[model samples]
Target chain A: MPSVKENTIVTTAAAVELRGLRKSYGEVVALANLDLSIEPGELIALLGPSGCGKTTALRTLAGFETTDEGKVLVDGDDITRLPANKRDMGMVFQAYSLFPNMTVLDNVSFGLRIRKANSAERTRRATELLELVGLPEHAARFPHQLSGGQQQRIALARALAIQPRVLLLDEPLSALDALVRVQLRDEIRRVQTELGITTLFVTHDQSEALSIADRVGVMYQGKLEQLAAPAELYSRPATAFVAEFVGTMNRLPGLMNGGTVTVAGRSLPVDGTAPASGSEVDVLVRPEAITLRPAEDGGGLIIATTFLGSVTRVRARLADGIEVSADLPSHQASALTAGTHVTLELDEQPVLVAAPLPR
Target chain B: MAQPVTARLGRGAAWAAFAAYFLVPMGASIYFTLFDRDNHFSATPYTGLFQASGFVPALQMSVEMGVLTVVVLLALLLPAMVTIQLSMPRLRPIVETLCTMPLVIPPIAFVAGIIALQTRLSDADPYGPLSQLVNNQLMQTGLPLLLVFSYVVLALPFAYRALDAGLRLLPLRTLVDAARGLGASWPTVLLRVIMPNLRTAILNAAILTLALVLGEFTLATLLGFTPFPVWIVTSGGDHAQQSTAASIVSLLVTWGGLLILSVFGDRRRTA
Candidate 1:
């Protein structure tokens, strides 16, 4: 990997601020007063399901969509009304978007050509970008000759050619196969960090966002439900939606007593805000947080076991008819099979307690 | 793999149908053009077509009009369609409907409307400036310019369909947005970015327009113009063999032009 100084365009990255961004089409509200702030050189991923306003916010910041009411500030300058061409922001769409008529080298140098850079300078910068993207040998080839991964890499290089102040990636790797998606996702993170350019990545893939972003902002119904670091978002999600969306969270009926929630006859301390005492609540627990012990007359029945390489996932139906899954070391779950009797025990950890859904 | 018996039979039947529909008529035309009086095969009719009076001039006029009509059609439709696609997409169906209107209006009816309008303008007061200009010698001499305009209308449906289908195959909105995002102006986006990508579509539209103009006869003859098709029909009055020979030559030219265009289109797409 190249050092930060090798291809860094800006010594200090720009800070981006999106405030009160609201957009609607007829009676449908795409974005409802969404606000977000990014520190300089930080990569923030707006993670959500489809139609969650994650893309709308990114487009508004890129100047592709005009917000009905909002302000987009980069480095303290308002660029809300600026046309997309003048925004000086690099964007990679879900599609390749590489100009089909041009070679890979020409596609990378397109922005420079539009900026009136001389031919020699264009070639030099374009060559440098191709090298950065690890496609220096394929520069002479047109887009059609390249694979989906290579095309997206070239697209990233092309967007970075102009050295824009900010980088906006809209699900840039969603179109690729699974293996390529992971490889390119890591490469993008490396490139972004090396350049230290503030970036906003919008994606519906929770794992992609969690694994790459400095902060993952979970969006739901045109609003940011929670924004935190990956570990923090996973370990301590601010809301039930975030907890359910980021990773698998088992919802088990529990009784809240004071600051603790009793689940499966075990009282576990609550994290964040706990529900009122003596009120029924749904306790959310991570799969890995649950442990199983075989017993001659246990109340839990192992419904199924799935081998996941390093870890084995065991699904158990409790005596109360609630199903919960547990991920244990393969060796630990090797003897457990369907119909095995086991006692489910909660690990001593902070669990979230929320009001049960209204029937 | 060996073909199934039923599939082979179906394929054979299709080939026989194709030969009967296309090859038979083409062979008859060639045979008629080659054979002369007393059933003697001779090249005189084919060679004598060039010697016929007004034949060369009519051919030249038709070629010129074909090229002009293609140029005019492209100039008017390309930008208009691109603009509508990029900015006012809601107007696309309306524009398509209007372009196809020429297909529903018969050529004879359209020519009658044009002649009626011309006669009304011609009979206006001579001292009136518009009437004087309309009756001028230059206007009378350039009456064939009206044929170019009418040809453009006639070619609209084919041109629009070709270009529209081509646009559908492309990520047009993304291309435009990418170009504009790279700081390209609208004209630069259209010409440098959009048009180059649409090479095959533009070629198809131009070929369609050229073919339509070259083969058109009714409007040209009724409007008192002597294009190639009209000349072929007129020559048949006194020389039937020569007319068939000219028709065969025109058919070859049209087929050759289309073949070259398709080859060029394929090469560009691969390139």
Candidate 2:
């Protein structure tokens, strides 16, 4: 096994900085003055829906696309005008971009060959990378002979073979099946940590980003809406878009008075920026934060119940015609079937509140 | 379980149609070539091929032309197609249309156009550089360079489709970018990476070009070039037996070559 500390000592990975990156196609903007800085040896995941500029940002950093306005710096060296071949960045695409004609070892050693490394050194390094990716025995196999997950692993090994200062992965696990996706996701994180390479991973799956990234950057409409650690991003979203995009958020009509918002006849202190007093706002609540109990005089009706292994989700319709879902322990939710009356209460945790939508 | 009566009849009819389409003509050709006037099978016609005048030279000329056509066609088309696909994808439809235009033009009309162009160029002022270049000894040789050019045009559609299909199966842009990112130059990427992956397509294109060159008659005949097909036709008027025998041999050779190519193409190594 390659020691993470030893690898880190051998090569100090470079920090990546993107300053005011802006790109557009005719009238439509893809990236709008996005600025971000990633630390050395840190893994940052840019998460967004399709066409949200996450891919555009990653490609710009990879030097595949020229930003209309921006400066890309690696270790404080300006690489904005550099061509892709000279940038020294390794990329693993969503599709299995392994050269189909070459065997696994050849694919991994392609960069070394391009760099004019002799045969013995290239083979040694390629063998080491294959072993790192847990496919040492598959060196002689062609790409088509491997399964999808195995092919992707080989692609990853090939990308890392170049010792790129910064690694870019564009939805590498999106093509994999669910079980293999999760398994490969953990495998990628393990390899990344073991190498201590600065990586920028672009993906649309929220759980994938949250589970793998040191910091998750939620993007919306060509802008970074919120960039925070996974736990902070999930619990305390900085914007309404981030709150809704990251996880299941139930929007409840509330009135903001002073620093508190009133929802479901209960007052709760707001966490982030709140609207002025006496303004209507939408209070964002997570399902697990809402507690439910069976009551004869309940204000909500349990309209549906779904068993989700460890937790059962119950959808309840309030008297005001607003429906909300609450997750409960499977054993406790056994009695809360559809058509049962249930009273709802909010926990005392600080909640995020957004300004009311335009009428 | 036994097959239904109607199903068996349908299968039998299909087999009969296949046999009629393929075996009958082949058997007749063989019969004509092998049997002498006494109606007894003999190999005299096959032996007569060696004694026929101009047979060996014409056959050699056609083989050389076929090989040259394949080389020139690949050299011209592959780079042009790769460049177009990489940088100028908007021009793909126009290029494809232009490549298939030869199929629309009859062979006679195409040869007439080439003859007219050659005449116009040859009749130009002798002192002019273009005229001097065209009137050179190399151009005056009876090597039928014009036939090779025409064969390349005729083979374009097949070559294009084979290469286009192969390129479509690959993520060309991504592959190029990946190679470039790994510090490989454009030439390196094309030769080492892209060309290896396109082995089957290249083989198919080359075989198609070779077949087109070998069997083409109108252009060669009208141009007064005695290539293999022209030789075969001219010999048919005098030595019918040798001509039929040569045709059968050529047909089998082409089919055998294609079969071998396909086998090589399919024999991809497993882990």
Off by over 4 Å in 2: A1-12, A307-311, A329-335, A357-359, B1-13, B39-45, B48-51, B83-90, B135-142, B269-271
Q: Give the runs in model 1 whose Cα sits over 4 Å from its true position.
A: A1-12, A272-276, B1-52, B83-95, B119-140, B239-241
Residues A1-359, candidate 1: write the lDDT tens digits.
44546753443589999999899977888888898999999999999989999998998998888999989999999999999999888889899899999999999999999999999989988888888889999988999999999999999999889888889999999999999999999999988988888899999999999999999999998889989999999999999889999999998899989999899899999988887889999999999999888886999999999999999999999998889999999999988899999998888988888778653
Best by DockQ: 1
Q: Fraction of native contacts in model 1?
A: 0.55
Angstrom error of the Cα, residue B247, model 1: value is 2.7
For TM-score, the strongest prediction is 2
Pairs of residues at least 3 apart in sequence or in different chains that clash in candidate 1? none
CAPRI quality band, candidate 1: medium
Tens-place lDDT per residue, model 1, B37-77, is 57889887788877889898899888988898988898899
lDDT of 2 by residue, A56-133 (tens): 999899888899998999999999999888888888999888888899999999998988899998998888888888
